[model samples]
Target: MKLTKTLTSLLLAGTMMLPGAAMAETTLNFVSWQVGEKGYGDWWNAVIAEFEATHPDVKIDFTLVPRDGYTDAMITQFAAGAPPDIVHLTSFEYQTFADNGWLEDLGPWIEKSGMDLDGWAGQGACVWKGTTNCIMLLYFGYIMAYNEQLLEEGGVAVPTTWDEYLAAARATTFDRDGDGIKDVYGTGVHLATANSSYTNDVLIYVLSAGGRWTNKDGQVTINTPETIEGINRWRTIVEEELTPMGMVGGDIDQLFMEGKVALRIQGPWINGFVQRAEPGIKEHLKYAASPLQPPLGGSSNVITLASETPQEKKELAWEFIQLATSQKFQELYSELGASPAPRPGAVNEAAFAAVPHMQLLIDATNAASAAGVDRIPTGLEAQNNEFAKVAAEEFQRMLIEKLPTEETAAAIQAEAEMLQ
Candidate 1:
């Protein structure tokens, strides 16, 4: 009777364990490239804390990879089948991952999340083909960083037209003290970092000149006359004493902060850095629209995001993203001087009113957002980077050395084809 009773208890215990006694824990690993202090990772940490507190059943492990060699680490992790549940995909690398089928489709999650992305351009950056592939969490517009004092000193009005922009660049440029050396430059070009975004920015010039980078059918259209015009206009900015070449690395931002350059095209983050890192620089800073149309004609803004992400995480990721970019968070970002998204009517009026010059940035982002156009699958972000380097360097040769326009255009077309 004792042995039978014990056997009965053991059988029951085994049955309970088979059904529900052993509960499994779901843990997610998130990897991002922003590892430095106050980087995106810092903000993500706060967001994760909130998520975990609300959902105690789930666990999240967040890791930030160094910005340098970030991609290599990601590939290694992926190869081992221990890829992080979530990864940060920048506009520069989105295509490569997506094309490889490494990402999960998040369309179902997006449909279920019921998040309102109407005002935000997040959808544009997150969508691939007809499917929504990624969730956009952050956005900032690229605009011309101008020197208010330099414009005032030169008696040059803020330029609105491309022609005027070129003239202003020339007027503001000079060897101020006549030391027989060019002490100041009117404008600057990014030659050092070799970032491919320059191609996108330069494409803005082509767009303003009424040129297209790709056809509606998805073909490269860079060799057209309008493109040639845009490229030539950029060259003039370099050779005609408007903007100078050789401003690479972070030199452009540094020079602009030091008031050596009158105008530069950069993001709002630089503005925030100036406010904290170099307080005096703030007094001279102002925001202006890109000369989309030649000396000053480009008037559009372009914002970029990455689309290669797994579907399962994209929704949750976007939730985190939405929280990060929500109007409330955007207001905080604006206060911190990080260029907030241009949701015009979406901005908090009271908060913006209290922050001086932030309104200008808001206005700039508005213009950029309105003018922002999406470039679909311009090739793998990696390929895009190479093409951009080729284009920027070619333009530099034309601007700095006055290389033949035809030759530069030809080279751009050739290299761009290789990317395709």
Candidate 2:
């Protein structure tokens, strides 16, 4: 009996040492493209820490899938029915997952928790097939990052309209040190590609001119006069040789960071990149509202619970979602990411102190949300990638061929209609 008792005690001790004895550490597999990004990474780490604090037995295994690989990897995992417990999806691509019913219906949880989603930026995008499938995490309007030294030396006031902006670009596009080569340019654009890398840069032009890629009703409105006007505005800048055309978004960002470019219309990530600008450039970097009202940049990213998530992990995943979308984390997102949170009023004094132009981004997001504007077309939510690609390709063709704005708009309209 003594030997048996000793053996039992040893077994119990060994089991205790092996973990999952008193309380098994339930790990929620989480993956994201932002896990390693500078500001966004910090925000996510803090959120995970806060979640872990409340649920000591829970561990969030955060993994980084680089941006280029993110969408494909996510699609493969979800299609294989082994999606991460915590699914992080981009707004444009979330439709595919939601459409396939790979994401859980979050409505029951919201109702049970009495969560109020009113005026939530990008919330509308989460309503797919009459179910709230995801909680939107990020949305933004374009902000113009400018070089103060370049603007002042160009002898132009800050531009509040496209015309003035053109003037600024013209004045700033000159060679310094008389190198006889035009070394400095006014702007940079990702106009040589198809899809989001090029779409966003061109979309802003259309959206700012009181136009849209598609109306709220999902009609192809690109052929409208407003769209033509916006195209003209963009073309004018290009014709004047104001922008270093054919560069990708990253190259443009790098040029801005090096103080080689005067201005750039960018999303919230710009502030973070600017902070690391090459030596003399960081101090002179300033932000302003893009020339016109920034259209709702729409849902950039969202968090969702996988529909096939294990029953045991469902509540835990929801809890994590709740924590992520909580006001505290939203506020932290604004402060740490230097990006506006989808949650209104997230850009409070605390966030403003840490992030430059917090109020501008917040207010823009709020106004766009209030107006029910989203960069995604109303009818083509599920077909966003296709629609955006068509739009981008047509726009690139127009620029390369120097086609008239009318022709460009017509081409985009015809191609967009095919998607519908």
* Clash counts for the predictions, in order: 23, 0
Best by TM-score: 2
List, residue by residue over 33-137, the lDDT tens digit for candidate 1: 554334234445666776777655457777677544565686676666566665666644554556656656666654675656676544465565555556554
Model 1 lDDT, residue 206, Cα: 69
lDDT digits (tens) for residues 132-229 of candidate 2? 88888888766788999999999988788887888888989988779787778888777655776676666677776878878877887888988788
lDDT of 1 at 93: 52
TM-score against truth, every candidate: 0.72, 0.88
lDDT of 1: 0.59
Best by lDDT: 2
